[model samples]
Structures are given as structure tokens and as C-alpha cells.
Target: MKQQDNRALGAWSRSSTAVLAAVAIALFGAAAWHLGTVALSVAPPNTLSRHYPRWIADHIHPELEQNWKLFAPDPPQGNGQIEARVRTVNGTGARHTAGWTDLSASDIAAVRSNLLPSRTDQDLLLYAWDYYALWHDQLPGHPREARLMAANLKRTALQRLMPQYQGQRITGLQFRFRFDRVPPPSWASPTTTDRPVNQVLPWWRVQNKDCQGL
Candidate 1:
């Protein structure tokens, strides 16, 4: 009876080891599947990605995907601004300029001091503007792309400033974006010879009927 009990104990130990091995393999496979999705999302398109296009669509489509080079090739050297001019029809029904509002400064000031600093919160608009500038007739081939970029910039800007126009009847609104290049470090001569270049975007007429369409 003692010999039979020992043999049964040995069999139980082997069974437990086999179960643990299977669990480990399953966990590893799960981890690898997620890692593959991430790898395919960011990596450049390849033959494998082409084959598994449906998988990427279901997993990491453009809306949910990310790109690395936001300020790439060469980073902007200077400061940037997105100033908004709001024209409102006052009580007399005459259109008057309500002065220029500096929307960019408000965004920069928000993220200057924070316990938990996030990149997407701080730079999404800033990058969106940059992206718009790059595509908007700068390269001179992508009219549709430029239009989409402009729409995105306008959408973000409007969302930020809509609260300020509570009581005012804003008839016209325009956004101007500026990007300045910084000078390289010269130990002997630190002054920049280059003047600031401004890319003034065309004025957009706002319509309450369809602000999203604007």
C-alpha cells in the first residue's frame, strides 16, 4: 500500500508541472500578440503589414494610431502664435472688431506648471497647427490634405475660444498662425540675423448654422 501511494504522488507532481508549462505558454502567446499589434501600428508599412491590413484596421487605425515625427526633418527654430480676431455685430447692428485674442499663450500657460505633465494635452494643438502649415501649399501638391489640416486647426481653436463669446454676437472670425525660426548657437556672435517669417492664414467666416462645416 505504501509503494502504491508513492507512485501516485510522483504522477501528481508531473501533472502539476505540465499544467504550469501550458499556462506559461498561453501567457507568453497573449503577450506576443499584443506586442505584434503595437509593432505593426508604429512601424513603416511592409509586406507583412500589407498582408494583415484587416488586423491593423481592427486594432490600430489612424484615429487610434500615433506617429513619432511631429516636429521632424528639422524642428521649428522660432516661436509660434495663433491669434484670433472676432468681429461682432453689437447692439446697433454694426460690425466692429473686438480686438485680437492670443489663443496660443493661453495654451502654453496652462501646461507650464503641473504635477502630472502630459505631452498630448500640451502639444496636440501646437502640432496640429504645425501640421497644417507644412501641408498648406508649402509643398504645393496636396490641396485636400491642406484643407483637412486647416479644418482640424480651426476646430481645435474654436473649441478653445467658444466659451469667451458667450454674450457677443460674433459675426466673423479669423485665425492667423505664426512660426518663427530660431538662430543657431554662435559663441562669438549670439544674435540672429534672420527676421521672423509670418504665414498669415486666410480669414474664415464663421457660421452658426454650421460651425463644424466651417
Candidate 2:
């Protein structure tokens, strides 16, 4: 009878140990799952600006307030105000003459369009072109130095603009910077030679519009 009792106690102890082991495993699994969920919920730091446009404007226009203070004293009255004229590809033009402190959504949209890839590679190509133009004007007839300056400007502009966003999806459209020499056929005089050509060598033209107006 004593031998049978010992056998029953041994069986109970073994079963209890097995049950505890299973419980421990389940608890551990639940804890691991909870930790993983918390990790996924947390967003990566500095992936995106808290206020994207304001942040961008701050970076782009650091002396904006100072400039406004200087210029606001003699604010342009009525239709004589400094106006931003946006010329679209379709020959339509829209004008905005709001104060610098009051930038409307339309103004922001127009600015964004200038930087956008679909409209033009303004961030990359235009930056390089403008730099080349400025450098060439400063030191005329120096192709090697002009090329180096343009390249450096391009690299700096890309570094400033091409920031990686965590949740934002980057498409092939965003990466596109391929420039075509073909001008739109709707121009008044469409000639093969009249189309704007990418100068193999940077040359300063007096007719070039000042990009600082942006």
C-alpha cells in the first residue's frame, strides 16, 4: 500500500511540473508579443518634420522675418504690390500679391509645383544651371571652374532637399530628373534650332531671368 501511494505522489509531482512549465512558456510568449507590438507602434525619430512646410520654409528662408521687417515699411499699395506671376505650361498665368507674412495655400502650391519632379527638375537641374550662370558671370571664360561650382551646388541642393521620410512612399516619379531638349510644340515659333539647348559649356546670358525672385 505504501509503495502504491509513493507511485501516485510521484505521478502528481511530474504532472504539476509539466503544467508549470507550460504556464511559464505561455506567459513568456505573451510578454514577447506585447514587446513587439510596442516596438511597432513607436515611430522612428526625425523621419519627418512635425510641421513639414514651416520646417522647410525655415530651412530655406532663415532671414525671412528680417527681410520682411526691412521691406514692410514701404508695403506696396493696391495693384502695385510685388506679385508672384506663375506661368503654367498651358500659357495660363496666375498672379498672387499677398504680403510675405501671409503666404496663401495657392502660393505654397505654386512653390511646390516649381520644386516638383513632374513640372521640372528645379531642385536639381535648375539649381545647377543657376549656379553655373552665376559662377560664369563672376569669372567669365573658365569652363573647368564653372563645371566644378555647378557640380558642388547640385550636390548641396540634393542633400538639402532629398530627405528620407519614414511613412512616405517614394515612387519612380519622385526620382525622375531626366531632361528633354524638345520644347512644347505650342510655342509661337517652333523650330528645331530654336529649342533651348543644354549648353555643353556654361555661358552667361544677360537675358537670363533672375531666379532669386522665387
Candidate 3:
């Protein structure tokens, strides 16, 4: 009986080792496939990359898509920030516009001096604004993308700035972008100067549904 029990234990150990080996192989293969697809997707337009554009895109889009521009060669030369304000209607039906809230500044503040910054603070509004800009060129253009971004901005404002607008119903939202080009070093261009450009967009009407859940 002791010999039989030892034999059973040996068999179980072998089976467990085989199972673990198979799982490791599967995980390694999955990682390899993901990395390969991501490489192909971000690589410069080559014959192979061009051939499997759809496949590569399918594997590494909207989530794993890489932006090489974040590094050297063509990094952002200008800093851009988005600010927002809300047009509110009081309980008595009086309309008023609130002070401009620096949304980008708030995000920067949250990320600064924090070891583990929240992803929402880091990427949420940043990516939303980037995608919105990609889909939109000018004010009153592309209602679909504009409405979506407006809703997101309004939701953010409601959460962050709600205390300031107590008793007032937010009815509209406005956005503006401030951009400042980095001035060249004095040694490089002693006379060069930089200026900040402020682009104020028209107000977007917000409905109750836009801020339904805050």
C-alpha cells in the first residue's frame, strides 16, 4: 500500500509538471505574438508592414498603438493646454458663466510629485482632447466628435468644480486652447521670441442627459 501511494504521488507530480510546461509555452507564445504585432504596427512603412496592415492594426490599435514622436526627432515643440467653463442656469432661470477652469493644469498638478499617479489624471483628458482634435478641425465642425468630447469635459467639470456651481444647472460648456511655442536658446537665436496663442471655441450646449450620472 505504501509503494502504491508513492507511485500515485509520482504520477501526479509528472502530470502537474507537464501542465505547467504547457501553460508556460502558451503564455510565451502569446507574448511573442503580441510583441511581434506591436513591432510590425509601429515599424516604418515596409513591404511586410504594409502587407499586414489590417492584422497589425487589429492587434495594436487604440490600446497598444505606439507613438514614436514622443521621443526625439520631432517631439512637441509647443505646449498646449485646454481650459473649460460652464454656462449655468440658476434655479430661478438666470443664466451665468462660471470662471475658466484650467483642466490641463489640474491634470499636471495631480501628476506632479506623485509616485503612482492615476491613469485618469495622466491620460483621460489628454487622449480625449487629442482624439477630439484629430477628428475636428475648427469650431462647429464634426458634431459627433465634438458632442462626445463635450460630454466628457462636462462630466469632468461636474466632478471637479461642482461645489462652485451649487444650485445652478449646467447648460452649456466652452473650451479654449492655450499654446506656447518653446523659444530657442539665446545662444541659438538671440533675437528669437515666443508668444502664447489662445483659441477660444464657441460654447457647446449641454443637455441634462450629458451630465446624467455626473
Candidate 4:
């Protein structure tokens, strides 16, 4: 009986070892595959990625998508900001134009102090503007989602100024974009003078419904 019990115990130990080894192998394989996919996604176009573009896109898109805009051979040389002003109608029907407010500055300030800033602070305005820019052409051009994007941007600006304009109806909104180019290093180009460029958009009339609930 003692010998039989020893043999059974030995068999159980071996089985457990085999199961653990199998699990470890499976885990390692999965991890390797994941790393390889990420590497392929970010690396410059290669034969493997070029051959299986669809497969790689399917693995990384919409969530793990990579953006190399800020790094590498071609990086952004300037920063763009959006500012807005509102036209408010007082109770007596007097129309007033508010001074320009730097909406992007508020987002930048929110991110400066907090260790973990919310996406609203970091991406809300930036992404909205980007979407608008992507879908719309220059002024007077109508494209799909162009009007909608404009409305969205105006809505956000209105929401921010609602408290300040209480009792007055927000009637219209206008946006301006400024791009500030970074000056080259003094050692590289000491005479270079980088100036900010501004483009002001026409005033867009706002609907009463759009102003509802702030």
C-alpha cells in the first residue's frame, strides 16, 4: 500500500508539472505575438507590414492605433490654437459682441497642474477642431459634417461662457485660429523671425435650441 501511494503521488506531481509548463508556454507565445504586432504597427513600412496591411490594421486600429506625428523625420513645427467670441442679445434687444476668449488656453492650463488630466481637458477641443478641419474645406464650402462640426465647436464655447452671459441669449459665435511657428535654434538660424499667423472665421448664427440647457 505504501509503494502504491508513493507511485500515485509521483504521477500527480508529474501531471501538475506538465500542466504548468503548457500554461507557461501558451502565455509566452501570446505575449510574443502581442509585442510583435505592436512593433509592426509602429515601425516604418516593412515587407511584412506591406504584405499584410489589412491584418495589421485589424489588430491595431481604433484603439491601439499609433500616431508618429510628433516624432521622427517630419514633426510638427508649430502649435495651432482656436479662440472664439460670442454675440449676445440682451433683454432689451441690444446686441453685444464679447471680447475674444482663448479656449485652448484653458485646456492647456488644466493639463499643466494636474498629474492625471481628464481627456476632456486634454483632447476635447483639440480633437473637435481636428475633426472639423478634416471634414471641411476653406470658408464658403459645404462638406459632410462641416456644419455639424462647426456647431459642435460653438456649443462647447457657449457652454464655457454661459455663466458669464446669464440672462442674455447667445446669438452668434465666431472662431479664429492662430498658428505659432517655433523659431529655429539660435545656433542654427539666428536671423530667423517666427511670427504667429491668424485666420478669423465668419460669424455663425446660433439657434435657440442649441443654446438650451447651457
Candidate 5:
């Protein structure tokens, strides 16, 4: 009788542990699913708003449109903007303000001319471009390539920025992209809080102002 009771107790302990482990796994899975849903809701997959022009378009209901303001906006207005500032070593090895600009093709060329003229500097600039491209969704070749480029750009940008840090640290060379909702024209304001303009425009309409020409 004593032996049977001991055996039963041991079996019950094992069963309890198994049940607890199963419950823990279920809880973890639920949490993971919830987090994934939230992320998807905030930033939908494959929206043009989430990627650059010229990349593969997501075939969903709303296609993405390209805005030149991303690179070279005339008077500059758009969701994607790159602002670059540079500091460089002066002849006396003291740091001086090199320059700053919104990153257009011209701006990129200027930065290359001023700071990264050497092979090393060129490499760093390439890295920075790749890094920016990844965020812009311009990288479509290979995931590995994008990853490598982002890493290299971060490393090179930091290396280039470090030598020029004077008593005042180089504080503000940053890149950011965001979603901006266009406000309704005065005529349409009374009807809605949401802007009437399409969040994603067609590819043809992106750069071209005349819809008829498109």
C-alpha cells in the first residue's frame, strides 16, 4: 500500500510539471502573435509608403507613389528626407564645420568632393548611401547585400565623423523618414479629419504634375 501511494505521488508531480510547461509555451505564443499583429497594423507590408520607388510594388489595394522630395524636392516637401551635416579636421587638426545639406544627388556629390575624396572616403560614402538606401527601400538585389551595406555604412560614417570631433562633439548628423498626411484643401476641410489626398499615388503620377500627360 505504501509503495503504491509513493508511485502515485511521483506520477502526479511529473504530470503537473508537464502541464505547466505547456501552459507557459501557450502564453509565450499568444504574446508573440499579439506583438506581430501590432507591428503589421502600424506599418503594413509592401506599401509604397514603406518602400522606395523602382522597387517591387506590393500588389495590394493601394500602390505606392514616388515623391521626388525623397531625394531632390523643389522647395523640399515629402515623407522621405535625408539631412546630412559634416565636420572636418582643419589644417591645424582642429575640427571645423564642413557643411550640411538635404541629401540630393548634388548634395551627395558635394560631400564626396569635400570630405571623402580618397578611396577610403569613397568607400565610406558608398556605405552611407547603402545604409540610406536600405531605409528608403531602394535595395532590392539581395537581402545580404542590404545588410552588408547598412553595417558598413554605419561603421564608415562613424569612423569619418570621429576624427573631426572637437571639444564640441559632432552631435547632429542624422537620417530620418516618416509618414505625413496631407491636409485637406479649405474647400474639403468641413467634411473630414482625414485628408482627402490618396496616401499612396500611382507610379506615373508621382513625379509628373500633369495627370493628362501621364
Candidate 6:
């Protein structure tokens, strides 16, 4: 009976060890499969394993996911400024035209002689005016794009100058831009010089839909 008991105990020990070994082997196999797939997913496009990587990237980091400009490119060689005027209507329908306000000058003042303020006034806000002018040149040919550009300008101006017109009820607004094209380098041909281009966009009635609150 003692020999029988010992034999049973030996059988149980062998089975337990076999089960643990199988679990370990399965875990290792799964880990290897995961690592191999991730490695293939991140491999360069030219490589043979790039099939999965390209597909994966299409799903995750698509081509249009980010705007990528050329490295260390020359800056834009032009200047643009936007000015807007407004007409305010009061009780009994009396109208008054507010003189043209230079929105670019205000933006410049915000970031001038200050270190902590962001470069937005110097580059982004100013560049936005340039974009607006470029869009204006396209005109009816690209109406959608032009409208979007106009919307952007209106939004920025509204945010910056809302306080100034808080009490008054503005009835309409007109916008215009002045762009000075930078002259070519001294060595370049005589065809291109500093040419001043003035663009006066059409007057747009201040609709309730055009602004957050007018």
C-alpha cells in the first residue's frame, strides 16, 4: 500500500510540472508574436515587411494627419495689413460710419517690446492677413475658399475689438488689405521690384450668423 501511495504522488507531481511548462511556453510564444508584429508595423516603407506597416500607418498616422513644410525653408517675403470699417445703427435708424481701423497695427502693438507674449502676433496673426489677401485674389473662382478666409478674419477681429463696440449696434462691416511684395534680390532680373498691391474686399453686412454675437 505504501509503494502504491508513492507512485500516485509521483504521477501527480509530473502532471503539475507538465502543465506549468506548457503555460510558460504559450506565454513566450504570444510575447514573441506581439513583438514581431509591432516591429513590422514600424518598419520603413521600402522593406519587405512594410506591407503591414503602411496599412497600419494609414489607419493611424495618415498622409494628411499633419502639415509638413520643407525643412529650413526661407520665410515669406511679403507684408500684408488688414483694415476694417463699420457702420453702427442706433435708435430711430440713425447710421454712423466708423473710420477704418488698422487691425494689423493693433496686433503689432500687442506683441511689441514684450518678451513673454507669444510670436502669434508677429507671425500667425500677421500671416493670417496675408492668407486673407491671397484668397481675395482668387475671387469668385474659389468662392468657398474665399468665404472661409473671410470668416477667419472676421472671427479674429471680433475677438480683438469686441470690447470697443460693445455698447454700439454695428449694422455692417467692410474689410480691405494692403500687401507689399518684397523686391527680388539685387542680382535678380529687373522685372520684379517692390510692388505695392492694395486689395479692398467687398463690404459684408454684419449678419447674426457671421459672428458669435453682434
- C-alpha lDDT score of every prediction, in listed order: 0.72, 0.39, 0.76, 0.78, 0.45, 0.68
lDDT of 1 by residue, 127-213 (tens): 778777767646445555667677777777777776776666666667776767677776656566576667565667766743554
Clashes of 2: 0
For candidate 4, list the clashing residue pairs, or say none: none
TM-scores, all models, native as reference:
0.58, 0.21, 0.57, 0.56, 0.27, 0.58
State the lDDT of candidate 6 residue by residue for 1-214, as single tens digits.
9999999999999999999999999999978766665555555555546445444433332222223245556676677777888878777677888888988888778777677778665675565565566666643455555676677777666666556776666667787878788877789886755678787767777766766653
Q: Write the per-residue lDDT of candidate 5 for residues 90-157, one digit (tens) a residue.
A: 45556655454444443346556784355444344543653546543754655554555554444444
4 versus 6: better TM-score goes to: 6
Pairs that collide, model 1: 77-182, 78-180
Worst 10 residues of 6 by lDDT: 59-68
Clashes of 4: 0
The residue-by-residue lDDT of candidate 3 on 34-148, one tens digit each, is: 9889888777789988787667755664457687666755655678888889899988889998889988888788899699998766767766766666546553444655656
Output the number of the lDDT-best candidate. 4
Clashing pairs in 3: none
TM-score of 1: 0.58
lDDT of 2 by residue, 1-214 (tens): 9999999999999999999999999999978754543433333443343334334333322122122335556531211111111111212333222122211233345567764435343334344544555656764655655666654543433333223322222121111122234443575575445333233332221111222222
Please report how far candidate 2 places residue 14 from its true position, in Å.
99
Clashing pairs in 6: none
Model 4 CA RMSD to the hidden true structure, in angstroms:
8.5
**Candidate with the larger TM-score of 2 and 3:** 3
Between candidates 2 and 4, name the one with more favorable TM-score: 4
Worst 10 residues of 3 by lDDT: 135-144
